[model samples]
Target chain A: MPQTHTFEMGMTCGSCANAARRVLEKMGEGITIDSIDVPTKRIVVTTEKSAEEVKTQLEKTGKAVSGVRITHIESH
Target chain B: LHQGKVSVEGMTCMSCVNHIQDTIGAKEGILNCTVSLQEKTATVIFDGSLWNGESVAEAIDDMGFESKLIS
Candidate 1:
């Protein structure tokens, strides 16, 4: 089952957001980025990967990650 | 210790610079890291036995930026 993970990131500019997007994109397949809003410092993604795994990857971007929440889930 | 220059792109603010410095500086064998947003480069002093220009550049590239070994 694919889960949507919402992450709190400390991004200061568009480039930071872009970097975050790229980091998540490189985490192999089965991951879709819903949004990476710099102003709100939020990143939303739907992926089959675990939240811990995704968080670990995001941290590699050298950004502070405040938290993660499972926003949505699909039942099928 | 050895010094290497890496050209990094996609950094727009001081936060980016500081993040690069803080992250890489804390890594093992990295003596220091100075990132210049204006110049779009990062100069790293690291243990030559543990790191090289290619590895340092690869580290920056892994951070979601376009990086190349300058020297």
Candidate 2:
């Protein structure tokens, strides 16, 4: 099964958002970040990693990352 | 010619990009400025004799934009 995680990251501007987006994109295969909303300070990513792992790694960036929610996708 | 790349964080939409670019471009010593939302970066062509990279970054910071020197 695949999953999508939404994270509220600390992105002060577009450059920072771009940096964080790049970091999350490399998480795993078939994983993709849907969008990064700067106004909401959110990084919406859909990945294969466990919800906890995604949150943990996202926090490791050492930024203001929190408010993570995961949605499970059934694999065919 | 001294060029500086100021990587800013938090700009989500074009409005933010416009605000930051407008603010920085208006600063003194900045000869040219290019902003990319995809790259999340602002490249400025300036006269080092007039201003330093720190100053350029500071200008953006003062405008409420999180900025760092990439170059």
Candidate 3:
């Protein structure tokens, strides 16, 4: 199943959005970032990876990462 | 080694990101700073021996914005 998870990344400014995008882009297969709200520092990512793994990769950017919510799931 | 992440609020455009990048980039102990208008978040890498969160937040506040650490 493909699922979208939201994470509140404690980002400071716009460049942080770029960095977060880069981290998502750099992650291994099975996941794709759908969209992100720069103003809110919230991101929605879709992935085949577990929620924990997704959060871990998102936090890898050195941003404060937390589970916001997960939805829009589809089975493969 | 110390790392910090902060949430920047009241930024409505890309210029806001540039403003923050420049401000944090100039801090004494900061080795790197990245800002995201898309997410309103900034991750900072600094020499902890030289600076801390309050000062960093102050720097952001001085820029005419609001900042708060997440962790």
Evaluate residue A67 in candidate 1 and report its C-alpha lDDT on the 0 to 100 scale.
77
Q: What lDDT tens digits, residue by residue, belong to model 3 across residues B25-69?
A: 876889888888777888888888987876676666544456788
* Candidate with the larger DockQ of 1 and 2: 1
Candidate 1, superposed: residue stretches over 4 Å from native? none
DockQ of 1: 0.79
Candidate 1 positional error at B47, Å: 0.5
lDDT of 2 by residue, A1-76 (tens): 5678888876666765665655565464666778988799988777667767766655544456688787676676
Q: Per-residue lDDT for A1-76 in model 3, tens only?
A: 7878888987766656766676677666777888888788899888877778777766655457885687976555
**TM-score for the A-chain in each candidate structure:** 0.92, 0.77, 0.83
TM-score of 2: 0.47
For DockQ, the strongest prediction is 1
**How much is A49 displaced in model 1, in angstroms?**
0.8
Candidate 2 chain A has its poorest 10 consecutive residues by lDDT at A55-64
Quick one: best TM-score, which candidate?
A: 1
